[model samples]
Target: MKVAVLALQGAFIEHEQVLQRLGVETVEIRQLKDWQQPIDALILPGGESTVQMRLLKELGLYEPIREAILIGMPVLGTCAGMILLSEGRLGTMDIEVRRNAYGRQLGSFHTVDTVKGIGTDVPMTFIRAPYIERVLSDKVEVLSTVDGHIVAARQGNQLATAFHPELDDGTRLHELFLGMVVGRSDKE
Candidate 1:
């Protein structure tokens, strides 16, 4: 299946590489025009949320993305990407976001544990990750957690993670996203 990784900034290339390793066709999304292409799924890589948001607005993709999620286009977001998908943020910014809740990049570490729906203990990398303070709706399903805070969640066709799964050798999360894309395509 074809998957588009938002390439505006951040570790998008890493996500593309991982997806390519999984035998999936991948593309770097730069313009809103790119989203018109027939792709089974999309991935929003970790980055600065404020900058990403501005880029999305400049590219006129903010609404398109929201619309796609409403229409059931499977999307997987990581780190800053997760913050973008959240209905609310916890940082000091105008939007409620717990900025650097996981501490700074230097504080980044590895952990092995079973994510709720991803299965088994997966090695997750967190760099200034944001935790889910409150899920806006029942549509969002919790997938994983580090402590009591929600780390991963799926809202219908949308899936988001506070950690970077691409940094590890494991492909469980990628595989799950692929499954979601395939499942959605089959229904079409």
Candidate 2:
């Protein structure tokens, strides 16, 4: 299965490297033509949320992506990606995310925590991260949190994290997203 990683902005390359390490083929989605490829899943990486949003729209990729996610295409969004998919943007997932909830670049940090369904001590790196402030839909499931702030969550086939798992060497979160992709493909 080929996965599409949004490459307009953020840490798309890091995510691609991690997925490649997992033996998964990934295609970089940088333009509207790239979005035309057959993708089993999508990964939205950490970066400037507003900038990413503008680029997505400028390149005519915003709607297609939102439609894809809304139609149950498995997606994993990290950091700024979380903001992109949260309320007011893609709005594909029923979540309210507070951007820069962890402050600026100076507030960046690393922490080891447990991610539900991915076991314990998962390495998490936060950089100007945005945490889920609240769940707008009952279908949303909280997966992990940091200092009472929602850091990870799942709703339907969408998985979002407030931290950059790709910045670390762990593979559980990527594996979890792959599992979601596989499960979705199986159901189809």
**Which candidate's TM-score is highest?**
2
Question: Which stretches of model 2 miss by more than 4 angstroms?
Answer: none
Q: Mind giving the per-residue lDDT tens digits that candidate 1 earns over 1-188?
A: 88999889898988988888889999888998998888778888998988888898899878877677667788888889888876543211112236578788876778887776677788888888888877666656778878887877776677788889888888888888888899899999
lDDT of 2 at 122: 95
Q: Model 2: per-residue lDDT, tens digit, 1-188?
A: 99999999889999999999999999999899999978999999999999999999999999999999998999999998989889999999899999999889999899998899998999999999899998998999999988999999999999999999999988899999999999988888
Candidate 1 lDDT score relative to the true structure: 0.79
Q: In candidate 1, what residue range of length 10 has the lowest lDDT sum?
A: 88-97
Q: Any residue pairs clashing in model 2, and if so which?
A: none
TM-score, every prediction: 0.91, 0.99
Write down the TM-score for model 1: 0.91
With candidate 2 superimposed using the best TM-score fit, by how many Å does residue 104's alpha carbon deviate from the native? 0.6
